[model samples]
Target: MNNIRNWLMGILAGLATVFLTVGGVRYVMAGGEPGEVEKAKQAFKSAGIGYGLAALAPLVVTILRGIVGV
Candidate 1:
């Protein structure tokens, strides 16, 4: 169970990093194109969400543990 928690936290953090990098690349390559810019914005939004989830990973693990009686 502790290993599961650690894995979950690591995965979430990694996803956040990936999203952030993708967002930055998209934004930089957008080149003022409306559609591309919109996509970049969405990517940034997803990155924010990923980061938020990463931040909440510990709490989430705790809740899951409680529900599972671990």
Candidate 2:
């Protein structure tokens, strides 16, 4: 059970990271000159992915804690 919980946490954390990073990159790129808007968008996407991961970390931690009965 503990092992399963750990695996699930890892997967969830990874997903969150990817999403937040992508979103961030897109958001950042959304700025800048209109011509470079595309490039900026890409960066913002990454940034978003990072943010998502950060948000997910807490949830993952909580689940892990529960699994360990802590």
Against the unseen true structure, what C-alpha lDDT does each candidate score?
0.84, 0.61
For model 2, residues 1-70, the per-residue Cα lDDT tens digits are 5565456557756665665566566556666656456555655565566556655666766786889788
lDDT of 1 by residue, 3-67 (tens): 87678778878888888888789889989998988988898888788878878878888998899
Candidate 1: clashing pairs of residues = none
Deviation (Å) of 62 in candidate 2:
12
TM-score of 1: 0.87
Candidate closest to the true structure, highest TM-score: 1
Please give the distance, in angstroms, between residue 58's alpha carbon in candidate 1 and its true position after superposition: 1.1
